[model samples]
Structure formats: C-alpha cells, structure tokens
Target: MSGVQTPSIDFDAFIFDLDGTLLDTADDLGGALNRVLADANVAPVAEHIYRPAASNGANALLEAGFGDKWPELEQLALRQQLLDYYAEDIAVHSKCFTGIEQLLIALEQNNIKWGIMTNKPGFLTEPLVQAIPSLSNAQAVVSGDTLSVAKPSPDPLLHTAEILEVDPSRCLYIGDAERDIQAAKAANMYSATALWGYIPSVDAALGWQADFNWHSPIDGFNHI
Candidate 1:
C-alpha cells in the first residue's frame, strides 16, 4: 500500500489494537489453543491459520480449532482451557511487530501519547502488556471489560480517548481488523489499518475506509 493518500488529516494521539496491530501475539495465542487441542486429542492447527483468529481472542480460536469437535457448552469449557493455557505462557512466543519498537520510540520523542484499545479481556491483555517492557508506559489501556461494550460498538475506543484526555477527533485508531476501523468511525476518530498484521485471506482492509493503510509499523509513523 502507499499508506494514507491524504496527509492532511492529523491527530494528536494514537490508539492501537493489541493482538494483530501493536503486538504479534499470534504464536503465543495459537500455541495456547494447540495445548487445548492436544488435551482433547485434536490435532493442532498451523500457526499461520490461527493468526487471523487471534484478533477475536479465545472465542474465535476455540471455534476455529474445535470446528465441530464439540458443542457450545464444550466449546466454552475448551475456551477457558485455552485461556488457562495462554495465561501460563502469555509472552513465551509473543513480541512486538517488526519496527514497532522504533515507531513507538519516535512517537514518544514527538511527545505524542499512545495507548492500547483491545477487545481482549483484562486478565490476558494486562499480563501481555506487562510482559513487554517497551509497552509499560502506555498512556492508557482499555480492555474488553473496561467499558460496557467493546469494539464495533464505540464504547471502548471512546473510553480510551477519555483516559488519554484527547478529543476523539484528534486521535488516530489503528488496527488489523475491520471491527477496529468500524469502532473508530463510530467514535469520530481517524482510523488506519495495519496491513503488516494478521489478516485473514478472505478479509481485506482496503475497503475498511481507513485514513491510511500502512504495510508496516514504521511506515505508519511517517503519517503520524
């Protein structure tokens, strides 16, 4: 992608989605679910196949892994099992996306505040962020339970804006999923899609109406 066609749009703060945007947590998440699959005698799915589902967290991963292996009640049990397994090794296979550290440092150097807004539950999101030292000083962090609603509803993004003390219109929300763009739109914030992140083959962010579609972390920083 050529990044955002419009450089006129500007923001004072930046908000990022955790899983597929700011952090490359796919390996850890997929590994965790595989542990559950192993216990159930179901073969593990390849990491690449599980990457897209990471944005949706445990529910999507469990559904993708189990498929028709079990019913709804059993899926719930297996989801918890997946979470339990993940919590035990939250950062074992997780890392910031390439060039993301340098991008974040550039943001800080510019005195532009940045934070995380994710649908991932607090139990998982907090520990994952804590595990990454570079993410420790996030201006704010709004997890799924932080508000009455998560992404695609606008509440979480709006709440995070409040926490950052920035007007929603002056903030840029970036993520690798459609729901993230949808939420940003509803909140009247500028939106961008991280094309370098985990996106499903069937999905495309080009039509997501983002102000920018960046192919890499540092590529996005230039626009900011």
Candidate 2:
C-alpha cells in the first residue's frame, strides 16, 4: 500500500486464486482429510496442523494427516477417497475470507473485471463455486485441469487471461503460494501475495518477490 497507489497502476482485469485467497476452505478440506484418516484408523489432525496445507492441495493435507505413515498408505486411493469426501459437502463450512465479499463487491461496482484461476480441479471447483453464491460472480473460472498443466507452469494463468479476453500484461494475479507468484511472473502479469492465505510458518512470503504483498483482503481493497 505504501509504494504503489491505485492511481499508479491501472490493471485491466484482476485474476484471483481460489482456496486461501478467496475462501477459507480449510475446514471443509480438513474435514475430508479427517475422513481419510478415520478410514485408516488414524486419529484426526487438528485444524492448525492442516490449515496451512489447504492451499497446497489435497496431497499436502494427506501428508499432514498421514505423516510418517504416508508411505504405508495407498496414496492414490486415499487421495481419491479424500476428494470424494470433500466433493460430498464442499461448502459446508466454507465461506469467503474476511473482507473478500466487500472487496469483490467494490470491484464489481467499479466495473473492474475479475475472475478465478485455481489449482483445484474442475470436478471439485465447479460444484464448490455453485454451492457458494457469491463465487458465481466470477466472469471466468479456470480450474487445474482446465489446461494440460497447472501452476508454476504459467499455462493455466495464461489460459485464464485468454478466457477473460485480457492481455496478460494488463492483468493482476493474486494468490498465496510461491508457485502462484512464479506462475504470474512467468505469464508476464503483475502479482500479489495474499498474506492472509494458508502460508506455512516456514515459508517466507517476502522472498517470493511479488509486485504487492497484501496482509488481508481489507488491505488489498484499500490499495485498489
């Protein structure tokens, strides 16, 4: 917010990563991981233990749950089971991150184009978006499988810009992970690291070198 004000940068479109960026889906994703663990007679992991892994995807949650037992479990089958459990009730405890709804409304009122680009697969992403009404406002929703590759590759980010009909250079991509920053930079788009997202304690967000580092949706909105 200090270095660049709204007047300095005029982005044609805003592209956001789902999960930690837009929605606090940790509870629901953790629920699925718990179910997988329960099936294996393993005790459920606590929210704090799994929350940081939410944005990283299902595999991270599995590792959080399985721990040293990860090698012993049938990873592929457990992963599928986790997805099945999650898909059953994707939005049960999921809701927008604090201030996200207000930020999104502000964008809409200003006629700023915004869309979603996430590594969450289409099968899970579509239903989750449908379950949450506010999420439907996204002009475009590009999931992990929407392209042949996912984040860190930049193809999905580029494809999302293509779908939104915006030049990659004119787009601002926001997400939580280092891979998100990598993808946005690779796509030649401006990037922001969502500090409020599910970043692990060990990961240094500042090292990612994003154009902006927003501590919260309110901070991001104030800057915008």
Best by TM-score: 2
Query: Which lDDT tens digits does candidate 2 get at residues 27-72?
Result: 9999999998888899999999999899998889999999998988
Predictions in order: lDDT? 0.85, 0.87
Q: Looking at model 2, which ten-residue stretch has the lowest summed lDDT?
A: 1-10
Candidate 1 lDDT tens digits, 1-224: 12345675556889999998888898899999899989888899997668878888788888778877555547667778888999999999789899889888988888888999999999889999999998988999999988878889998998898999999988988999899988988998888888988776424778776877888887766755
TM-score of each: 0.93, 0.94
The TM-score of predicted model 2 comes to 0.94
Reference-based lDDT, residue 127, model 2: 92
Query: lDDT of candidate 1 vs native?
Result: 0.85
Model 1 is weakest, by summed lDDT over 10 consecutive residues, at 1-10
At residue 9, candidate 1 shows an lDDT of 55
- Misplaced by over 4 Å in model 1 are 1-4, 70-73
